[model samples]
Target: MQDLVNLKVISLFHSENLVRIPELSSATKLELINLAYCRKLLELPSSLQHLEKLTHLNLRWCKNLRFLPSLYKATSLTTLILSDCSNLFSFPEVSPNVRELQLEGTAIEEIPSSVESLCQLISLSMEDCARLKNLPTSICNLRSLEVLSLNYSPNITTFPEMSRNITELNLQATAIEEVPSSIECLSNLCVLNLARCRRLKSVSTSIHKLKSLRGFYLRDCSRLEIFPEILDTLERLRNLDLSGTALKELPSSMENLIGLRQLRLENCESLVCLPESFHKLKSLWFLYVYGCKNLVIWPDNLFSAIGGASLTGRVEMQKDLHGLSSLKELDLSGTNLENLPTTIKQLTRLQKLILWKCERLKSLPELPPSLIHLDAHDCTSLAEVSSITKLFEQALLCKDKPYTPKTLACLFTNCFLLDQKVVASPGTPKLQMLFGHMFTILKDYHQASPQRNMFTTCFPGSEIPEWFDFKSSGSSINIQLPSEWYYNRHSMENFPGFVVSAVVSFQDYFDDAHFHIRCECHLKSCNGDCPNLSCSFTVWSRRGLHGSRLLGSDHLFLLYHNELVRRFVETQASNKCIYKEASFEFYPGVWERNWSQCISCEVKHCGVHLLSAATDDAEVQPPKRYKYVS
Candidate 1:
């Protein structure tokens, strides 16, 4: 092994004091070097490139690292990773054989023409390089390049000429104005994404010549006015996205795209109507027209071809969308729609329906029973809903009035039936179902809850119910009582298994006069079987405001199951202080697995007392303290 100078790995784990690379020029065998989580390391050795055998190098998550080593001498390097090195400002010169490179979340401003020398490079990514502006024209020399991703490159003005071998290319969120004419030279391209390219205005006409193209995405390009006459040339195209574009109408020639499966025109605000020949797209399965405020109807015969003869008997009008039985997901939210086509009931495959912010929608038409997720928030005109029992997993309904007996079977949390009361059905099935719905709501918006308080009394003071008290013991200490809980169940008969309880304690330790509080939590599940519950407790005690006083201990103590898991006892006075009156809300089925599992608790304090110095100035002498406990 002594004679072997070339090695594959040089892994350094948690070696924080290692400041510079050792003189390894004599060992010509280094290929891969991995420096993982070396926090205190500030810079790299300038002689790192002396190793001609080095190839792969990883410097992931080195937070304090500010610069990269010069790589001009390491001609054998092929792969490099500088991911999450937030302070890195530049890249070293690239060698020809380098194929895979990732520099995500760095300050590199451009891909130097020096990279063009890497003729063997295939996959290259510079994602989240916010300040990057250009790719050198020399990039066209990489004949083997296959996948190139430059997403979130905000300042990028142009792409190097397209490489023929490129199969997948992503230029999302860029400032490119048009697809270069040289882009059509790539005959093997399959997927091309220019989504969110706001400055893009036009596409090269040569796009019609790429016969192998299968998918094209052009979403959020608001200034783009016309689609190049390439629709008829894409014989294998399966997905096409012109969503958020300024297109007013589809070209009559678009009827030739017989193989298209997905069409998205969402937020195409100016599109008022569809062409009649749109029905020719027999392969269309997924369609999104949400936010098309001006759109009034589907093209004639559009649904007839998609639903087949099985749905022909279900609808009388060809303009009705209900006959489209093959359709899977529909997002007609925020349209000027008042009444949905009753024929929509035929789309048994529909899984999701987003009707949020549709203020004018008075009611939902009969929907397929197979629906799984429905979001109908802020529909002011909505009053009642008919049978919706099929979508058991999820349902979000923030209605003004609470009408019961429809789908009250699903457990729900954070169900804001404002000013309305809830009446639950008997048995564990209904209880379980009700809790499922409730749990889902709470988990979704728990972070936004203003109270932020984790623990609270179930019935407040003096209102503890009889179920809480064990009949035999005459005390609530045993008998498998449900811990802290939240519910509207008036009796066991209406008890839905959807709600469960857990216990936890919280307190803040003060040096002399410590303040502490503990409580239990009862949560409602949104869906799925409820689990055995536990509680979240926190104790925070500090010396003084901003932790400036030496009289008090500024330590925090947290325990679960009577075992200490976290301690914040400090020896010296710290400037930062913990929040007071910590509060948080827990998910119905999930409890603290560790000290950090608790959600952020909001502190609300009342009953603040002030001490008087005049009453007993001599008697209130300071007391000597020993070991400080967290």
Candidate 2:
């Protein structure tokens, strides 16, 4: 120890066995000491007080540390961290020059008034200090303090007056009942979070005075029945979350928030409607109001005003729905609407439309051409989906032109009415036409480009179409390919790959069950050489309580993969090698639990079909198994 007189730094990071640090009496020039994650460290050497050059002292995660020596005399210290010292019960007096002090997860009961002596402190965090009760009012005298966090301090029943220079303040899950009007004095404050403060009932209207405030969160404050009206424009405020609150309505003055971009009001059951001027927020792009059961009506002119806004609620259809030209996603789950306005087809850029539990919707209108995903999982009253036939017809009409391929995925998991009406009809002509149109689109899309796009659908059915040339009773199947089968002498399209089909039967209802069909493909050449080219893709996934209720019955899953399969087979073809046999093994299961659980499923049957553009008249053949010969 005597030979370390010139030592300037000491770091014992993660030394879990270190019980204590040697005295630093002789190392007067020591400038920094780090003992982070030294869980067995109980205390610092008292000789540490004599080091005049010590500028940084980090003791983070020292769980057994129960006390810290007074650092008031260490005038040169600028940073001190005692975070996660679970056994420490008192705040240590730090030097006036200290710029940052962290005491998060400590057992400290109260902050000493002498904390005001830290005039140069820039940040003070005491988050998750369960035993902490009150902060010294004298802390407001810290003129240089900018950030203060006291989140999860349940005993903090009153909002502490803070320094005027404060920029960010977090008091989430505290017991504060109201934000006093004096809060406006924090002129430079940019962020204020009071989320989950169940006792919070009111906020001073003076909050509008925070000219630089960018985000304000009051989520899950169940007792907050009203929000003060904004009298002036707050152009910099971008995000405001009031989800899980009890507010019945918003003040019309919200139109003054011209720069707001995201607003979340999820599960606010008491909220009946949005303000009439809600459309004035042109910059708002994402709006979520899911599970607001009483929110049955939308403002009449709301859609026409916000040109590109995304919203979800029980919409009261208006004559014109095309005003939202730039909207991309819309979720109207759990609504009572019976039908969508025909103008929905005018939303040329709409991509995803979610209607998970709209039980009263009896039919679907023709959707936009840009539609990619349509989720109507449990629409019990839906009996007509003729619009799908029109979509296929449109694709057929444009088969000759060069265009980008648009993939589509539709989920009709438990539409019992639709299944009885369409799949159970006398000859099932509609069902057959739907499958035929889908095939035409797949062929047309493959001819355009090799870009990977998938088309998948899920519906109630028990049998595979007879067109599939290869069929198996279980989950595995093998197919034989003729030499030079990929090359066609007729048209320009190289090869139109194959389609896979599976029948899955569920045993019992599973909450949040995500069904997936994985296929492992292996290829073998005529020379006995085998290349393991394995690939798997998710064929079907479903969630939500309503969607899983009726999933106990059998359902059919279909997938079309042209480009994906081509990339694999063509790799071997380029080597002047031909794969005479291809084998596939299917595994179907739910992601939520193991196969032995009460919620289980089995793949009852599997089949495959190959597509070719060489001939216009193709006939369905009998099932045949292919084997590789050495």
Candidate 3:
């Protein structure tokens, strides 16, 4: 042990029965000592302070440790970790050179007053320290400290003034009742978390002085009924979450937060209205206000707020809102009141607008050209939707620039007023090798618009669209691939895809308007093997849960594509294989026997057609199976 003087790293971790650290007064060259998880370690030698070159000391989970030597003599010490040390009640004095000190989940009841004098300290974390009630006020003078976390420290009721350079401050689940007005003096503060501070009733309005502040979280502050106003201070504020709070209204001066990007207010039962200033937050992108049952209508003059001038001392809100030009997403699900203001259409740049379960809504307004994704599901009273044809017009008109397409998924999942036309898809040689199937029928095959990749709506028809490739009149159909489909590279480069068509029997209305259809494709390979690929889809139509048969069959179509099939056929096909057989079966929901709607769906027709006339290079007729045999 005497020759271990030059040891730079000594790890005696998990030494479960280690009772005491050996005298290290002579290990002057040692830099790191890790005794973590040494559950029986009782004490550290006071001579440890003589290890002047020691830089890191870790005693994490050393539950039996009760005291540590004064580390102030270890001038080179930069990191000290004592997390989860249950028996330790006090921290040793650390050197001013220490940069990070962690006592998270420790039983330490008080911090050394010397902490404020550690000029080089950058981060001090003592989270989950239940007994810790207050921090030394001198710590506020540590100008170099950037992070101070006291989250889950229930006993901490008051926080002292903090350094202006602190970028993050976490005090979640604490007993703090209020923050001092001096908090605004922290101009560089970027993130402040006060979530679940139940007793926190008020905050200093001077918070606006934090010009660099970007994120503020106050979720679940049940008693915080009134929030202080920030006249015009935070220009860089971007994300603010006030979810589950007791807030009834937001201060009227939020318009000046021009850099605001997202605001979350979900489950705020008492919130009744949004400030007119919300409309002028031109840079705001995402706004979530779900489950705010009391919010019914958005003011017609959302761009104009009352006492607008008095709300801010200097920054005047623009008198106009030509749509939130930079806004991309907005959620207002689960509300009560009816129609949306006509001004909603002014959100010209909006990409998604979610309004699920708005039971009182009856009609949709004129949609914005930039609008793509929309969700209004479960609106039982909703009877009318604007013309679906115009939905794709704007997307088609703008194809020269980058655009985010509105999600085509479940766009009208439960809207019974809309009808739909169905299309079936066929597999190509490439598709046979790539994956199993491509729902080409559902993909926007005809639309040249880049933003409208898929279309979903309720249409009035049981017949397949006349534009389908192959036409048939049966519940099942078999089709062969064109000869030498894989030989020509142009087959995939120029070919759009095969179009399959089928008529669904919707004459009988089920208890639930939603239907599940599983399409299975069985391939009989030339190598005497058959493989099946199957997929399922959930589709909703105008068919009522309980309605008259007068509605007849609701025709449906979907686009299908798969990657595994294309790769398998191209490289795994048998040598003698010139032609292969493909068959498809459709089943409704969980019942395997009910492949078709009604007792038996009269197959209006089942057929496949090659998407392009590349027959000049490869014929559609089947070739001899033995053509390539030895």
- Measured against the true structure, the TM-scores of the candidates, in listed sequence, are 0.57, 0.82, 0.70
lDDT of 2 by residue, 159-242 (tens): 999988999999999999999999999999999999999999999999999999999999999999998999999999988999
- Residues 390-427, model 1: lDDT tens digits: 23212223222332111211111111221122235543
Clash-forming residue pairs, model 2 = none
- As a TM-score, model 1 comes out at 0.57
Taking all chains together, the TM-score of candidate 2 against the true structure is: 0.82
Candidate 3 has what TM-score?
Answer: 0.70
Q: Backbone clashes per model, in order? A: 51, 0, 46
Model 1 spans > 4 angstroms off: 1-8, 13-18, 36-43, 50-52, 60-76, 83-91, 105-114, 211-215, 233-238, 255-261, 303-318, 321-325, 387-630
Candidate number achieving the greatest TM-score relative to the actual structure: 2
Worst 10 residues of 1 by lDDT: 560-569
Worst 10 residues of 2 by lDDT: 302-311
The numbered model that scores best in lDDT is 2
